[model samples]
Target: MSSYYGLPVLKEPVWKVPDVPAYLYLGGMAGASSTMALLADLTGRRHLARAGRVAAAVGATASVGALVHDLGRPARFLHMLRVFKPTSPLSVGSWILAPFSGLAGAAAASELTGLLPVPGKAAGVLAGFLAPAMTTYTAVLLADTAVPGWHEAYRELPFVFAGSAVASAGAVGLVAAPAQARPARRMAVAGSALELAASRRMEARLGLAAEAYRTGRAGAVLRVARATTAVGAGLALAAGRSRAAGVAAGACLTLGAVATRYGVFEAGRETARDPRYVVEPQRERVGAPGSEVRGEVHRSSSDGDLQ
Candidate 1:
């Protein structure tokens, strides 16, 4: 493999560390919390439902703040809402975030204030309906990028994200309303299992791109994430009405989810910084004798169509 004067083929992501990772964490938590709230309400766990609503509202608000801070201007976010492009994950994500934030806020307010109960339930339901997309769209956004680590893992990224979201929401429930958190315990156990399994599969299948997740800062955080998530899930299963144990499990789960997001972000950045992640794959695709010319002709026609 070779590079153009030893330079990275793709530009490194400009997204700031804490801001982008925080947005991903909070958005996923908010989306899953909304869904959990609706489920709790249906199951007659009023306290748990209320807690979920509040968590969703606060998470969504903070998520938006983090995003706008990264963009350096609120107008940039508003500009995203000016057009809805289904083919573009960013555009679709903006639309999902806007309504989800509003609905989550309304649901939380209604639940807390005892006013407009009808509208609050309606808002909660609608937010729940949008929750899955809200939780997973960030994965799509990441995968759509040119970064090898992220793009190559697209097949399992959504599952990893969704599981993390659910686990985070469960953590909130455990922390906020442990007395009525049976459903949360179940979610915590199930979500963590799914996340761990999907993540392992993604890494195993990533080939050379997996180097980004196996070395450097990304690897350290991901290792911690896996350990904490597994511990949290085990603790959740044995908690069984023990408030202290539930809280401990919740804390561990929250840390794991945060670490996972940060690790993934760092892995993507690492891939962009290394030229091999770019050159080696293309070389393999066009390695055979006479294949380079044929590949160039195919790419030329594809580029023409795209143009």
Candidate 2:
């Protein structure tokens, strides 16, 4: 019934600390590394498998540490596991993180100690099965919120997140297990392609809501991310003859993935900061011609005493 121009209709996200994005980056690395470990095990690439398992364990553990630090207290992290709510991403994520961490830790420990081979291999398999959910659920968590950029891009965010995950894991593999860099290179290229395509589609479809991602600091960061991703993917696919080339490609991919996460988070903040993003859409939806007329009449009658 009231004009909302230049007025914020919703609160921005409270997750302003650096830890949140760090957590997201580390979690993606863990999930993708877990998947790589599973594939390497199946293919009997022992070196690569060991690298993936170690990466998964370290990344997952670091992610949890970030989450706990972000919460301002360790107990809040513990509190998240008090219940298992299927509908809540954070709840489901907590459960997913718990088991995945254990499995990853087990796989890494066994690899290091050269003991308990059978159970460790089983844990790796199970962790791989849960890897997709671990990597992509954070997208759902962000999308479920009221932030315009995040909510509007829900369709493609999962693909974006997954692609970033793959690129990250591939970068780690390239550095940690150079002997088996072929698969990592392939994954990086594929992931970069998917991320670029999905991001383009998301921008094309978002209309006015997409402005947050196209202007200011967020825009610059995203542009750099895209450019780096393309360059990294090209180098990775072509780095067959030189070790230096492989390292450069892997470094670029890792940087691009990190930039993507930060850019996405900043874009969401930009959307929340701009009132037009919130007000104009609601105005279009609720202040159509007929609705505007009815609203005016109601307001006029309510002010009859003044008249």
Highest-scoring model, TM-score: 1
Clashes per candidate, residues 3 or more apart or on different chains: 0, 0
lDDT of 1 by residue, 1-307 (tens): 5577888899999999799999999999999999999999999999999999999999999999999999999999999999999999999999999999999999999999999999999999999999999899999999999999999999999999999999999999888898998999999998999999999999999989999998999999999999999999998999988999999999999999999999999999999999999878776767766797667877888889544
The per-model lDDT (C-alpha) reads: 0.94, 0.87
Candidate 2 Cα deviation (angstroms), residue 146? 0.7
Model 1 steric clash pairs = none
- What tens digits encode model 2's per-residue C-alpha lDDT throughout 165-200? 898888877777788888888888888898899899
Error of 1 at 88 (Å): 0.5
What are the clashing pairs of model 2?
Answer: none
- Model 1 TM-score, all chains together: 0.94
List candidate 1 stretches off by more than 4 Å.
288-307
RMSD value for candidate 2: 3.5
In angstroms, give how far residue 46 of model 2 lies from its true place.
Answer: 1.2
Alpha carbon deviation, residue 265, candidate 1 (Å)? 0.3
Query: What lDDT score is found at residue 194 in candidate 2?
Result: 85
Q: Which residue window of length 10 is worst by lDDT in model 1?
A: 281-290
